[model samples]
Target chain A: MDNNIIRFTYNVDGTDFTSAGQASVMLKKNLRQLGISPDTIRRASIAMYEGEINMVIHADGGVAEIEVSEECITIMLKDSGPGIKDINQAMQEGFSTAPDDVRSLGFGAGMGLPNMKRYSDHMEIESELGVGTTITMKINI
Target chain B: MKITTVKELLEAKVVWGEELIGKHVYSACGSDMMSDVLAYVKDQSVLLTGLVNSQVIRTAEMMDMVCIVFVRSKVPNQEMIELAKESGIVLLATDKRLYDACGILYSNGLCGNGVRRG
Candidate 1:
C-alpha cells in the first residue's frame, strides 16, 4: 500500500477562459480534505493555477497531474500546442505572448512562469518549438 | 475588519454570501490580474477586482480569501456566483471603480502584504 502518496488527474478545457482555474480549485478542496497545511496548500495551488491558466492561454488546454505526499506535493501540466519558443524569456516577468484577449481577462502580465517559480520549491519547464510544453513544479508540505 | 464593514465602506451590493458578511478579514489585495493576485498576494484574506469571471472566485479560493469585491459595477454571472457559493466566499459589487474602492479600503486600514506588493 502506498500510504505516503495520493494522486489526482484533471483534464483542462481550453475553449472557455471562464473555466480555466477549475482544476486548481478542485485541487485546493482535495488538499483541504487531506488535512494538508494551509501554507503548503496555498503554494501548491498557486503554482498549479498559474500553470493551468498558461495552458489555456498558450496551448488551448492540457492535462494536469497532482501528487500529494507527506513530504511534498507535485504538479505536472502538459500541453500539446504551439510550444514556447523561448523558455528563458517566457520565465521572465512581464514578457508574454498571450493574445490581447487573454490580457483582458486580467492575466498575461507575463507573471505565470515567475509566479510558479516563486511559489514552488522546485520548477522545471520542458518545451519544444511546435511539439508541446510540460511544466513540473513541487512544493514541500 | 469584518466583511460587513467592507460592505458599508464600499457601499457595495451583496451579490452572494450574505451569510458570510459577519466574518472578519485582516488584509486585502486589489488587482485585475488573477496571477498578480496569486503572486504578489500573501496572507491577504480579501480580493478586490474589476474582473468578472469564474477565475476571480477561484483565485480567491486558491489564496484562501474570505471575500471578493467587484469594482466598477462589474458583476459576476450565475456560474461565478455558484463557484463562490461552493467556496463559501463572500461576494460584493461596488459601483466604485477599482481605484476608489481599493483606496477607500486602504485609507480605512484594510491592507495588503504590508509592502503593497499587489
Candidate 2:
C-alpha cells in the first residue's frame, strides 16, 4: 500500500471577524478538485470553519493545518490566546464566553466546539490557561 | 420548491444570482446564529437569515445551499453579495419577518425535515 498525504496550512487572522471562514472555504474548493465526496467535504469544511471562527473570536487567530489521505482527513487548529479555562464547560452547548457583539454578527451562540465534535468522527482538545490551545479533529472518508 | 418560488412566496428581491433561480431546494432552515444553522445541515438547500455578513454567504456555500432569504428587508453588504455571486448562491431580501417568511414557505410545502424534492 502506498502512503501518500497532502497537506495545506492557512493563517487565521484574529483581527478580522469577517474573513474568518476563508480558510475553510478555500479548503472546500481544494477538496472538491480532489474529487472528495460532498458529504465528507461538507463535514470537514463545517468542522474546520467552526474552529477557524473560534480562533478569531477567542484566541486572536492561529494556524490551521489540514492533512488529507485516502482513508481520512485530519484538521489541527493551534492558537496562542488566553486558552480555554474549562474544556468541559466550553464543550457544553449554549455555554459561551463570547461578548454581546459577536452574537450580532450571527455567531457566538456557543455552538462552535460542540459542532466541531458533532461533525467529525473523532476530536481532541488540549489547552493551558496562560499558554495556548490546540484542537485536533479527524473525519473518516 | 424551486428557488424562484421561494422568491415569489417571500416577495424577495434578488441580491445576486438572479439567473440561478430556476434551481430546486429540498429543505429550508432559518436562523441568525451561523453555528445553529451549521448544526442542522441535513440537505437543507435554502437558508433564511436576517443576519447580514459575508459568513452568511460562506455558510450557505459550505452547506451546498442554493439560496438564502434575507428577512426583514435586510440587505447584505457588497462583500456578501460578491461572495454569494462567486459561489453561485442566490441571495434574496424580503420585508417579512423571519417567522412569517418561514411560515409562508412551510405552509406552501417547503419543510425543515430535509425532505427530498420529488
Candidate 3:
C-alpha cells in the first residue's frame, strides 16, 4: 500500500448554526486540490458534512480528524456532548430529537446519520450516555 | 442545460460567481431540507432550494453542486454569498416559486435526474 498520506484536523464550532458545515467545505476543497476523484470526494464530503452538522446541532461541538491515504480516507469525529441514549434509534431514518427550530432551518430531518452511513464505505459509532460519542467513517479511494 | 439558460429560464439575479454563469448542469433538485438534499441528490449540479441559511450553500458544496437557486424570492445573507463565491458555485434568486422554477427548467431539458425517485 502506498503510504503517502495526508491528514487534517478541524474543531467544529457548536455555538453557531451558520458555521456548521464549514469543516466539510474546507475538506472538500483540500480533496479537490489534491486531485481526488469527484465521486469519492463527494461521498466523503457528504458523510463528513452530516457528521459535522450533527455535532453542532446535537453535541454542541466536536473535533474532526481526517487521514487520507492512497487507498482510502478516514474521518474521526468525537464530541463531548451528552452521548446518545439509543444508538439504534438515532440511526433510524426519519427519527430525530432535534427541536422545531432546527426544522425551521430546513434540517433536523433525521437523515443525517442515515446519509452518513449511506455515503461511507465503512462506519462505526461508539457512545456512552454521560460521556461522549465518537463516529468513525471511511471511504475507499 | 447551460447555467446561463437556467438563469434565463428563472429570470433570476446572479448574486455571485458571475464567471460560472456559462457552465452547464444536467439535473436539479428542489428542497428546503438540507438533510434530504444530501441524502437524495446524486450527481446533481444544480440545487433549487427555499432555505436561506449558510448550510444551503454548504450542502451544495458537499454535493459538489455548481449552482444554487433560491426560489420564492428568498435572499441569502452576506455569509452565504461569500461561501458560494469561495466555492465558485453560482447563486441565483428567482421570483418564481420552487414548483414553477423547476417546471420551467424541466420542460426546457433539465430533467429530474438528480432527485430521488419514488
Highest TM-score scorer = 2
Of candidate 1 chain B, the 10-residue stretch with the lowest lDDT total is B109-118
The residue-by-residue lDDT of candidate 3 on B1-118, one tens digit each, is 8898999889999988778899989889889899888887677889999889888988898888999999999999998998888889999999999999999998998987765422
What C-alpha lDDT, on a 0 to 100 scale, does residue A43 get in candidate 1? 83
lDDT ranking, best first: 2, 3, 1
Please write out the lDDT profile of model 3 over residues A1-141, one tens digit for every residue.
Answer: 445889999999999998898899889889999999998998999999999989999999999999999889999999998999999999999999998999999889899899999888899999998799999999999
1 against 2, candidate with superior lDDT: 2
- Docking class of predicted structure 1: medium
Answer with 1 or 3, whichever has the higher lDDT.
3
Residues A1-141, model 2: lDDT tens digits = 335898999999999999989999989999999899999999999999999999999989999999999999999999999999999999999999999999999888989999899889999999999889999999999
DockQ of each: 0.65, 0.58, 0.64
Model 1 lDDT per residue over A53-87, tens place: 99998899999998888888999999999998888
TM-score of each: 0.95, 0.96, 0.94
Error of 3 at A117 (Å): 0.2
Ordering by DockQ: 1, 3, 2
Give the candidate number with the greatest lDDT.
2
State each candidate's chain A TM-score: 0.96, 0.97, 0.96
